[model samples]
Target: MSGDDAQQHIYKTHGLLLNPIMCGVCGWQFYTLGIYNAHQWMQYGERPHAFRCHAQYL
Candidate 1:
């Protein structure tokens, strides 16, 4: 496959968070439902939503 085509295919099922240290193209971090921290992850003292960075689509 061409480079752009392959990249587009991958983007459809994957996403990368803004963590530059965690490589987005390879070895990116993925978050699950239970990995949240109540103290650190709170938005205005409440978690607005479960933020997941599913590096590998599934």
Candidate 2:
């Protein structure tokens, strides 16, 4: 299936809402907490202060 179709299937199968958690710094929305955490780790490494926005806002 196409990427959009696969994503729709997963969301439907898991009963997930489309309202994702958005990053204040980059305006990127995360569908899951795990993915959000992973993005933070990959983007800013272990340093929380390195982020342009506050962690509490995330």
Score every model by TM-score.
0.25, 0.42
Give me the runs in candidate 2 sitting further than 4 Å from their true place: 1-18, 47-58
Per-residue lDDT of 5 in model 2? 58
RMSD of each: 10.6, 10.6
TM-score of 2: 0.42
lDDT of 1 at 8: 40
Q: Model 2 lDDT vs. the true structure?
A: 0.61
Indicate which candidate wins on lDDT: 2
Q: Which ranges of candidate 1 are over 4 A from the true structure?
A: 16-58
